[model samples]
Target chain A: MESNTVISIQNLVKRFPVGGDFFTALKNVDLKLHKGEFTGLIGPSGSGKTTLLNIIGGLDSASEGTVRVLDQSLDNTTHNERAKLRRKYMGFIFQSYNLLPVYTVFENIELPLILNKIDQANRIKRVNQAIEWVGLTNKRNSKPNMLSGGECQRTAIARALVHEPVLVMADEPTANLDAENSHNIMRILTKLNNELDTSFVFATHDEKIMGYLKRIIRLEDGNIINDKKIKKEDV
Target chain B: MLFKIALKNLLGAKLRTFLNVFVTAISFFMIIFMTGLYDGMRQHAKQVTIDTEIAGGAYWHPLYDPMEPILFEDSHSTLPQDIRSLVEKNKAVPILVSQAAIYPNGRIMPVIMKGIDPGQNIVNMPTNTLNNNKDINIPVLIGKGMANNAKLNVGDSFTIRWLDSDGTYDADEGTVVHIMDTENFKLDIGHIWIPIKKAQEMLAMKDEVTYVSYAIGEKKVKKSDGWIHRDVNYLIQDIEAAIEADKPSIQIMFTILLSLAAMGIFNAQVLSIFRRGKEIGTLMALGMTRAKVVGLFTLEGGINAILASALTVFPFGIILWWTAKHGVPMPMDYTEMGFMIAKRLMPIYSFGLIITTTILVFSIVIIVSYLPSRRIAKMKPTDALRGKTGI
Candidate 1:
């Protein structure tokens, strides 16, 4: 593993149990993600893109190969250790904008910092800054139910960036948004990615999302078919 | 931090939280109130029995057993010099008990005849009433219960029959001089009281008595000759035993109330976990360990007890406080039940009772809360995020 590598996966295999048999999700996959890189696992549903992303995020385990994120191997770690890894160095965003519905935007953004046991003054300051970065300062005190889809997705992005984690894994982040909201969210995420120098891995098949990725790994039938790097001008 | 999250979740639940807390508060109040009432009954019964019948303590004849009325004939003995000295000094009162019957209104009713010194003021019984009606064949002091049963009022005459020490039956016309009302049913129901001298002359049991009762707070003496000195606690065993026998029903009630409250909390926790699987998964995703998640839910449940305790301060607490201050009026007369219960029973809420009740209810809430929350430990974060039910 290089010092710049945020995630290193070697021949990773993940399986789920079917009736008296096993259904493989990711098959003998090899991948490496570096710091400050904007990458996406581009695939349709059931192409194992989400499975690979979950393995790298330490939310799920590999059955056969080693997955190391930020110098820690996921295979040997306990559930509590995995939680600590996510708590200290990783953030997550879901397509559904999984911000806790009962919490206000500021509270949702402050959750990671709270889990990190940051002091109250620091938490408030960082949460306010993240809210500003997402252009949601006016809606910071509004709960998710009160926010538009775009605003809710912005809050999720703010939460994923509030702790300045080394890695952020987003799955179908813009699946539920319109083209305008999708672009707006991608723009905010791209700005935060550059500003924070955070590594980002997105699993999505959306063309709008693909345009924003500097590197794209395409998967088909649980296997990677192409891995390519592109410049912003090429899109 | 955990407390803050738990409280937020509970408050966010709104009506569900209120309903659980209300049930818990009701259980808490009912337990304390019922226990306090029982305590009041015990204390009142003990105190009144001591004041009216047992006094401070007594010296009982070796053969005396209050439950065995057949032994009353053989349970009498001439007082020892030491006890006689106490009676002479007005520090004690001697009583002779015998099994007898009364004929009133053409009814043959059995009874117990007690002989006490008319001038003795050691006990609260109105024995001085026997001193009146010197011209009557026998001026007897009957309690309200005996008088009511015999249909004999003051100055009414009835035929009393009893066996003498020689085993010969004798009869006399007894006039009721007074009907005294007392809480101690042992000294009231189906009992007749006559002056010791007249009773001794009539029964041919000269200078012999059953037991001697010392004045209230009198120093207890060691056993003299064949006599047994019974302490106040020993003498009050019947009342205590009666109360102890009735405790199981109260215990069953407590179990039901506590179960209802616990069940409410348990159901709420189950529903919270089931409905908020995504939220739980999200929390785990953000780095909360499953144990912490369980603690969070358990704390939510435990907070019901805290909130219930706070809720108890309104209505429940006020009602308890008012009842403590000015006794609860019993629905019916309990004098005939022979239990020395006051008309308005005062509740005694001891410090120990309150502390024990709080800890008990709090622990139950925590346990029920934790029982359902344990499912979080077995849940796969991915499955939870997909809104899959673990239980």
Candidate 2:
């Protein structure tokens, strides 16, 4: 564990009771995420990268373990408390872009802020800034379907960051994009991490994405096979 | 924002939305139309009671009893002079009345020929009068129905024929001094009016009246006594009892028809809910609470019912106006009373019916959407994103 550790997971275990028997999804997973880090969670299908990310993000519960983020113990909170924690401290980007199709780019970005009950004047200021941050100010009023794959992904990222959460989670964020769009999304995520000191945890299998991250955690069969940090100077 | 999303989803599948709207509209229309018809009947019945002035729990006899014929002779069933004086002495009694009959053509075709006392009958027959010169000749006030049937106008002369005590018929011609609009026409089939005094002379029955009507004041009286003056409730009960005896089959058929119409509305709403399952699911998945999803569908149901009610009101209004203006004719005879009992019972449209049906349809929609919305709301985001389960 590093001195700047923003997230710490200890002996995290998740199991599903399927057909009168227990099926383990994550086996005693342990990991640490440091501040201002661009981290990649890499694994094959059923490797439990998504499961671990979900548990750490407070989107799902671990059957056994102590997971701590921003000094809040995930194991000690109620479901509503966990949801509130997710809303305030963590933001999520899905592979499908998950932008509510009925909303324009601006409204999608403003959703999390609205849920937090931020006033209209401040909400508009923050949302406009976010739209500009994602370089989509020109397309703020456009619906998700009107945007290309790369723009939609950027909109998702803008939504994640609009509330200024301490941690941002991306689950296979580039899976639906073309190679060019994928590279563009990675660049946007990397740049935001470097400039704003926001921590990003990405669950992905893209090899090209791995090169941009300072830390890479690889899982095999729900067990961490490799955990390594690359110095920014080396990159 | 969620509402906007819901509206968009509602509009997404144009054909399905149209189907829901159409079903709602038709159900609404049928419900409204049936209600209007009921109101019209009630209005018609009320008008018949008012126009005929059949007060004190009495309706005009449906047809003259064979044992008690209402003949032009005016000698039969006449109220004696002493009885009239006895009626007037009772302070609780408001009016004591008698009528006479005349047949213009000696035939049994339904007609009204009222012969009321100029002094005693002035309250009920407020418009009765002599010709302008105040002569003793009884002026005739004809109902529109009679005037139309006989093709006679004001000041027209017509012949009256009657059966004598010897079973031979006699005839006399008279002039129609007045023609009446339908609203004022109390006679149900066809009718004519004449002065009671003259009627007695023509029928050769001295100091005798055909029938008696009395308006009793509020003082309590013996319930089962054979007084002509009776309360409205008693009158209605008598009419209902008579109708039950005479037309039981018609009553049964009307009940069945009303039940079928109600069932049609119920079935239409049920089918609408079944068809909109996916649309409801989509609304719930878009972060709408289960209550809101149910509310939207309920609102849709209420909207349909209200629209239908509004649409039905106009046509029903026209029918009511027609009934009010033109009395409905009875097929049977009511010659002695000088008017047929028009079924002038108009329907009364009320806010309560609208509110009740709205709530009923809304509840149906809410109950129908409950389980479906809950199932959709509980689905995982991944499953929903994949459009699995088609919602």
Candidate 3:
């Protein structure tokens, strides 16, 4: 284990049973994420990027490999321990900006903090701050149905970051948004990652999302074919 | 936070939430209302009997079985000195009961004849009508139920035939001096009332009575060899037992209404799981345990019960209050059907009834809500995140 490594994966393999046979989703995948890095698992639809993201996020168990997240081994942790790990150290964003439709934007952002059992006065203060961070202050009381695509995506970002998790995993977070909303979301996400010194990992196929990544791991089918770092001045 | 979210969800789907809560509220209201109404009827029946047939207590001839009219011919004794003293004080009424056939409109109708004193206030009856000064004809009082059945009216004349103590058949014509209405059908159905002395002369059994009915304040009826002391509670025991026997059926009816309410809540819970799959998965991904998700859904369902209680208390309470204050009228004469019910009933809502109903309904809502939410524990977060429903 490296001192600064927050996520380390080695010889990882995930197999699913289909029609009494096995379909491998990831094979001998090796990856490492250091602190404060903005990274993307870049791949096409069948490239197993989301599968690896799900595994690293503790949403799925690894079948035949070692994976460690935030210094906790994914292979040995119990289901509840994995849940606690996610609650304390990880946050997730999804493709469709899955904000609870019945909840207001402020409430959606407050959910993670509430799950952590933060006190009411501080919870309200943090929620308002997160609302400002996502630039949805004017739309704080609006529900998901009342918000535009960019606003909804901003609310999802606010929800994911409200608890100040060490690692944020987003699976195609801007898939449903137009190009303008997509760029706006990436700018806020990048600014948060740089300013807070938090690690970010995204699973995406979009060229636009790839533009913001400092490190890109390219996946072909079930294998990682290329890993590269982009300098800030290169863009 | 979970409760707030649950409440917001319920408020969001306004119509679905309302239908479930309305059905449950109605069940809650009706369950308490029906039981209270039935209890009220029982109470009314006991009170009316206390006022009419059993005034505190009575002394009955040991051989007298009110059911067996054949034994009434021998179920009598000469009045004792203590009983005579009570009669003098107007605290006891000696009734000589005999079975007779009346010729009314040329149709023979068998009836029970009770002779009560005109001046005695031991029981509530229209026996005062026996004071009519019609010397040529024996004046008798009849209830409206009997009058309706026999087509007899006040001032009408009829022939009554009875067998005297010597086993001789005697016949005479009597005039109907009053037609009274009462709450106790046992006092009215197939019965007629006349003066005790006139009954003694008519039956040729002087100074003999079937039973000595003590007034409201009378006690210490001396036990004779042929009479038994029956307490007031013992006199009304049959009615109390009959009312007790009807309770299980009433519970079953309320259980059914509660089931309807439970089913409504259960259906809503199931639909919520199916419809809100994405929301559930999002919560799971946001670090909520599956149990907490289940708790959130169950809490939502429980909120329905609380809301239903809030929604129903005032309106149903108003109806119950109005019914209690001003008795609710029955479409038909209840006492006439021999049900021991009054024409108007004031429902008695006991504290026990309301508490039990609330507990039963709230418990069912919680259980049914949790039943459907259990599927969340079995749901794979990845699939749920994709908005899939097990398929």
Candidate 1 lDDT by residue in tens digits, A1-235: 7999998889988899999999999888998889999999999899999989888877788889988899998999999999999989999999898888778898889888988999999999999999999999999889888999999999999998899999999999999999999999899888888989999999998998888898999998889999999887888
Give model 1's TM-score versus the native structure.
0.86
Q: Write the per-residue lDDT of candidate 3 for residues A193-214, one digit (tens) a residue.
A: 9988889999999898888999
Q: Residue-wise lDDT of candidate 3 within B1-391, one digit each (tens)?
A: 7886688788877787888788778878877787788778889998999998899688887878888999999998887777667777878888999999899989999999988888777788878778865574678888778888899999898999988889999999988899888888898889988898899999998988999889876777664555777788889888888778977977787778677766766676577667788888888888888787888888987898899898767788888889888888988875556666788998998889889889988998888778767686558788788878763
With a 3 Å backbone cut-off (N, CA, C), the pairs that clash in candidate 1 are none
The regions of model 1 sitting more than 4 angstroms off are A205-208, A226-228, B1-23, B61-68, B74-90, B117-121, B126-157, B165-168, B173-183, B195-198, B204-208, B220-228, B238-264, B298-316, B333-344
Q: After superposition, how far is residue B303 of candidate 2 from its true place, in Å?
A: 12
Q: Determine which window of 10 residues in candidate 2 chain A has minimal summed lDDT.
A: A78-87
Best by DockQ: 1
Instruction: Write down the worst ten-residue block by lDDT for model 3 chain A.
Output: A77-86
Tens-place lDDT digits, model 1, residues B1-391: 8887787777866887888888788878988898889788878887888889888899999999888999999998899888888899999999999999999988999999999999999988888778867699888898777777778899899899999999999999998899888877888888899988888888899999999999987786654688989988898888788778878976776677667766765676577667888888888888888899889888888888899999987879999999999999988767777667888899999999889889988998888878766786558888777777666
Fnat for every candidate: 0.59, 0.00, 0.57
What is the Å distance of residue B38 in model 1 from its true position?
3.3
Q: Candidate 1, A173: how far from true, in Å?
A: 2.3
Candidate 2: regions farther than 4 A off: A1-4, A17-22, B1-37, B52-76, B80-227, B231-233, B237-348, B358-375, B379-391
Question: Measured by C-alpha RMSD in angstroms, how accurate is candidate 1?
Answer: 3.7
Candidate 1, which CAPRI tier? medium
Predicted complex 2: DockQ: 0.09
**TM-score per model over all chains:** 0.86, 0.63, 0.91
